[model samples]
Target: MLLKRLQPMMFQARRNYVELMFQVMGRALQAISDVDEPTREEVRALPEGFLFEMQVMPNGPKLIVEHTGDGKLHFHGDTAPRPVDLSIQFKHMAHAFLVLSFQEKTSVAFANDRMLVDGDVSYAVRMTRVLNRLESFILPKLVAQRAVKEYPADIHLPEKLMSSARIYLKVATQFVETVRA
Candidate 1:
């Protein structure tokens, strides 16, 4: 499976690049939602104000955002000292992030066992709201662009299996669209 090849590379990378991107994007959303001048100032000050520990694993990473009374987003590795205020897990940090980027409802994915989250329910709820607000601001620009990259070489699959898989995929896609409609 492609996952077998990719999983090792993902772990070795260590930094969880995808998770870091989400943190930056999520913080931007929080900044946009700030109500008053003071809140806006607080949000502006957040780049260095909050502390977050990110851990990506077989089930994905957990993100703990700690906004100290002061203002700074202190990023920590998985083995940080403070207790986690929130945690989210997915098959990979990439999948967790794509769920947010694609504007898919995480609850549906979570219910289907595709994602898992724990710790302060209120914080999770607030995160969802923040994501919703962010989606409106980000999706339009994202969807308008095309993302295509050429592989070093074309991959070959067993002919019979490839044909069968194509047929199955087409049918499955149609079925999903029908159900959604």
Candidate 2:
């Protein structure tokens, strides 16, 4: 009796959590896409007009990114009216958040059958590199260490600090521009 009564509430709570994850991930991806030059370079391997999407199943949240150098992340309702070149879909909202929150690496999730991919293998590999670069920038070293297969050892404190500062400044500026627009 108690289980039945609690099921609906649990479902609602999970839905809310997934919605929040989508929003946060969309914004963070936008910020990273806007400022990270290396990530932009990595994305150059994609086709000239490619569209990539990261989406959660069961009608959960989604984010889209165009391959244009200046492309910013777009939430579901804002996606372009074109076919996607590649898509990475989480099996469910829980899996989406788990990967987004860095509790699970994207590659690991894919290996575990928690994710689905619709794209060319080489392009997907490049996209994974871009995501990994973004993760290195957005997450602290300690946390990122756990999320990535191998954090680069050559990035000493000085370079790391300088790049982090620049990334943060650019992300802040991008946020302001987005708000003003």
Candidate 3:
């Protein structure tokens, strides 16, 4: 009887955490995608209306961003209104949080069966590259190295400093936008 009484509360707590996870991730992705010119170019080059979704399992929270060929990403307030071109689904909240916290790399999570990919393989690969770029900008060099397949050899001190400054400012701006909306 006591277990049953606590079940709903536990579920609600989990739901809240998942929703927060998606919201934070959405802002971070927006920040990274907003400032990087190369990443913006890559997003623009994607097929029009391409939607990418990263979701937690069992119909909890999801973050959906679309590439509209306008050099900017459209982050959906709700779920993806249109069909998803590529979906990376985490097996559970734990797995999703692990990746979000940078304890597990995205590639490592996928390779270890912690995630499911549903869509075109080639497009997913491209999307992985884009995600890697974002991770590089946001994560420290040690963490980013684990998260990405390879670090760019040409990222020198001046460029790294500039990129870090832009990424930090963008993240702050996105946080404000998220809070305001």
Give the alpha carbon lDDT tens digit for every residue of 11-53 in model 1: 5564465655544543443334332133334434343333333
Rank ordering of all candidates by TM-score, starting from the highest:
3, 2, 1
Q: Is candidate 1 or candidate 2 better by TM-score?
A: 2
> Candidate 2 residues 45-98, lDDT tens each?
666678777777856767676765444443343365698888888898778767
Q: Measured by TM-score, how close is model 2 to the native structure?
A: 0.77
Model 1 lDDT at residue 134: 35
Tell me the lDDT of model 2 at 46. Answer: 65
Once fitted onto the true fold, the runs of candidate 3 whose alpha carbons sit more than 4 angstroms away are 1-18
TM-score of each: 0.45, 0.77, 0.81
Question: Highest lDDT among the candidates is held by which one?
Answer: 3
- Model 2 misplaced stretches (Cα beyond 4 Å): 1-24, 27-34, 70-78, 178-181
Best by TM-score: 3
Please identify model 1 stretches exceeding 4 Å from their true place: 1-17, 33-55, 58-63, 68-81, 101-103, 141-181
Alpha-carbon RMSD to native, per candidate? 17.6, 3.2, 3.3
